[model samples]
Target: MPSEQDLRTKIESGLPDLHNLIVTDISNGCGQSFDVVVISNTFEGKNKLQRSRQINNLLKQEIAQIHAFSCKCYTEAEWSKVVV
Candidate 1:
């Protein structure tokens, strides 16, 4: 089983410019579920689904290791909206 640190490393490698990346392991010892929230400028012009697809594509291998992933991806603008 890959450690959380390993997973985070892989994610960071895949999306180098992503900011505010939050990854939580929701499954104990299963390595099969996660909750992720990521903020990035790469998501700026994309819709929610498109943004998700971009993440999913980058983490395709990780997806096989994961059974469930609840993801929330936001652009800087969207994140600012939430902060305000």
Candidate 2:
């Protein structure tokens, strides 16, 4: 029963300096699956696996209950490039 808002709050608390976050429940509001994107300095030097691990660790308990999850993290600079 991990709501998107709950996950968002936890991520914000964990990455206090996160620049941006987007969480979507891909399970059609069932809360079983989620897609998350986080832009933060925390991922500045990390590779994909490291960034994923950081987010996975941050939401470990919630992840255990969810059916599927995906996290994409980027630094502010990287984010700008991706979106632009």
Best by TM-score: 2
The Cα local distance difference test for each model comes to 0.78, 0.94
In the predicted model 2, the residue pairs found to clash are: none
What would the TM-score be for candidate 2 when compared with the true structure?
0.96
Best by lDDT: 2
Q: Compared with the true structure, what per-residue lDDT tens digits does model 1 show for residues 9-29? A: 776777756777888888985
| Model 1 pairs in collision | none
Q: In model 2, which runs have C-alpha deviations exceeding 4 angstroms? A: none
- What is the lDDT, from 0 to 100, of the residue 17 in candidate 2? 74
TM-score of each: 0.81, 0.96
Deviating ranges (above 4 Å) for candidate 1: none
Residue-level error in angstroms, candidate 2, position 84: 1.1
lDDT of 2 by residue, 1-84 (tens): 999999999999999679999999999999999999999987877899999999999999999999999999999999999998
